[model samples]
Target: MTETSTGGKGAPATRRLSAFLYRHDRLRLAGLLTPPILWLVVLYIGSLGVMLVSSLWGVDSFTGSLVKKVSWSNYHTLFTEPVYRTVALRTLGIAISVTLIDLVLALPLAFFISKVVQGRRWRYALLIMVTMPLWASYLVKGYAWRIMFDKGGVIDWMFAPLGLHGPGLGLTATVVALAYLWLPYMVLPIYAGLERLPESLLEASADLGASPLRTLRSVVFPLLVPSVVAGSIFTFSLTLGDYIMVKIVGGTTQMFANIVYDNVGVAGNLPFAAAAAVFPIVVILGYLLAVRRSGALENL
Candidate 1:
């Protein structure tokens, strides 16, 4: 009799709480969003804040100990040093090259998948194949590229008939590897954009006496800019911070990320590494702001 009485009282209390929550829509929304908001603020933004603060601290040159005092010596070195400038420029060039290569390759392929492919099964299978490379480990893909770029490897074997040879391990190989790694990031966005595009627009262009090439240039290209910008954000930012792919295939080519890795791991200078890390963050922020100003981010 006592257990039955307690259980009967608990049921009414649970009903009251659920009824209260259902009555207050704003409160319910806040309850749903609070966990993820807290997670983002504490983990992502908090780590970035810590890194920015650490970048201001100084390092002792002689003893290799942290100086604890704040200073701008690290940023000053990055600006004044010619080698740092060279590495920064090289990193930017590689990133831009990779973005352009992926853009060219993805445009035709994404169009085919979105517009020209006849059946649903064929389209899905091709999309899966485009993304299949991502299922493998990152290092595995890097080393695989290294092997193919090696002397007498698959690349050389393929080119032997044409009396040419592989570019071997260097900037050429690094760019090619980075391009292959990030191609899917570029493809999916463009494919989705193309899928959302109205076929009637293309029909109108054709009925108006526009050729397919002209229709693509005038009608399709303008509508796809936002997706292209979205895709470039992934490709460009990823290539900027990548160190491992360059390490495996870059040979003596030192990128901006390599400088940061060396400072922290090899030189034992955490302050300098944090400062070096700020460059890409700033660059990406600028790119995002520019995209926003152009109204492309709204569509995305």
Candidate 2:
């Protein structure tokens, strides 16, 4: 090994790395993170704070300003009103269902990509196609969902000849559409985790007289908990936040996101809209925190 010019011989690499970080790379890395940090602060955190404040207040028409009473009336209305309760439950249900179905579809597909399949270029191409829906306008995507679930739409036509009569424009269609849209999000995270699993470990499982199913149950699934949790979080949170797709494909009586939109836009009750937004955040955050605390996140 080569010695340094200094009396200390082994510090050359460390000194070079420290210099590079301080002089060149550190600032660049910080710059890269700044925009996203700004976005989180200005857009996400700022909006959430404003909404929280609004949720605490009451709207009065004659006063034409929010009453700073900081009461639970808004939340109380959410629980006491049957319509609100039903819609909220429906929203939560749809989010959970979407997350689960996407997980079911993604796990096998990711396993295939990681274990059964080769030629990653083609596989990645197909993965990109699945996420292409995200590139389109969210409104257009919702409208596309509307087309698929319309009475004379392709979904109905496909099942019509079989005498199974497709019931379009409702909760079921909304769930299916959300699942279809979020499935890619689930797949990407799972694929990442699956791809990173060691090949030799799988071989070892096979050597232990474990069938493919058993190996998956004991070995693969355990290692994939983190990926599953992450993917489920994305799917659930996205569906919970989505109103446009549900509104386009669903009936007048729908979920909480729709209810929030109605209150803000149609009902002109900003405080209630603010209150409605809290349900999804509270539920989603609570679930994610639970998962993280339960040792599931560490596996990732």
Candidate 3:
């Protein structure tokens, strides 16, 4: 039988490429990373830089046009205005509330799903149930919640027997909607972290005569801190930037995002909006810094 040359020139080509990559490590790394680096620099960082610069610039009230001249007036207004302060604080409060609510709800459910649940199929089913909401449209979810919060709606109907009523389109409704929207984000991370936890350690803790609560406090929670922080980063930042849900369910309550939108669209003041937009970014950065300080990010 005649021997056929398998792989033809593929082997030599692959070997040559491997040799070149090995010889030029920096070049290979740059080649691998250049696309993402370019995207970050050109899109994300560039947009942020533009926002910062525009926030510093002023609008010509006489001509009703943007002035290229740099000024601190917009930021000064953001600082000095009472409405701005109130809205900023309110938005911060709502974000914090959403994060806390999601965390409280996610922890136990994640533990149940990751540790207590038996069989792979059941575990996957629970995870799917947890994540299924995310497949729905964002606007659809918001509007659905809006309907539920409306007068004589599902929430009102449910609470009517208790001689109470739903928190009609307001801060509470907004927080509830946000928590519902972001809960999956919080759950998945904690579930993953919990699943990754060593069963042997848990066994050891029980063997060492630690109660369930004590074991969780002294072992599980400490290891889960990084995942919790990671999840909160998403929930907090998403809540901070969200304006649509608030618009739908928040009624007259204006979040920082709502204020920014009003300034940009109603007031026709992009510079002022840009300046106001810096607050959430600053707040999120501060949170990330706090998380880092606690060494959770290092674990991540």
- CA-lDDT, candidates in order: 0.94, 0.85, 0.92
lDDT of 3 by residue, 86-179 (tens): 9889999999999999999999999999999999999999999999999999999999999999999999999999999988999999999999
Top candidate, metric TM-score: 3
Weakest 10 consecutive residues of candidate 1 by summed lDDT: 291-300
lDDT assessment of candidate 2: 0.85
**TM-score, model 3 to reference:** 0.93
Winner on lDDT (1 vs 2):
1
Model 1 lDDT tens row, 1-300: 999999999998999988999999899999999999899999989988988899999878898888878889889999999999999999999999999999999999999999999999999999999999999999999999999998988988998999999888999999999999999999999999999999999999999999999999998988999889889999999999999999999999999999999998999999899999999999889988887898855654
* Total backbone collisions for each predicted model: 0, 0, 0
Q: Which runs in model 3 stand beyond 4 Å of their true positions? A: 1-15, 295-300
* Native RMSD of candidate 2 (Å): 6.4
Q: Model 3, residue 237: what's the lDDT?
A: 91
TM-score of 2: 0.84
**lDDT (Cα, tens digit) per residue for candidate 2, span 162-215:** 987677888888998889888889998899988788988889999999998899
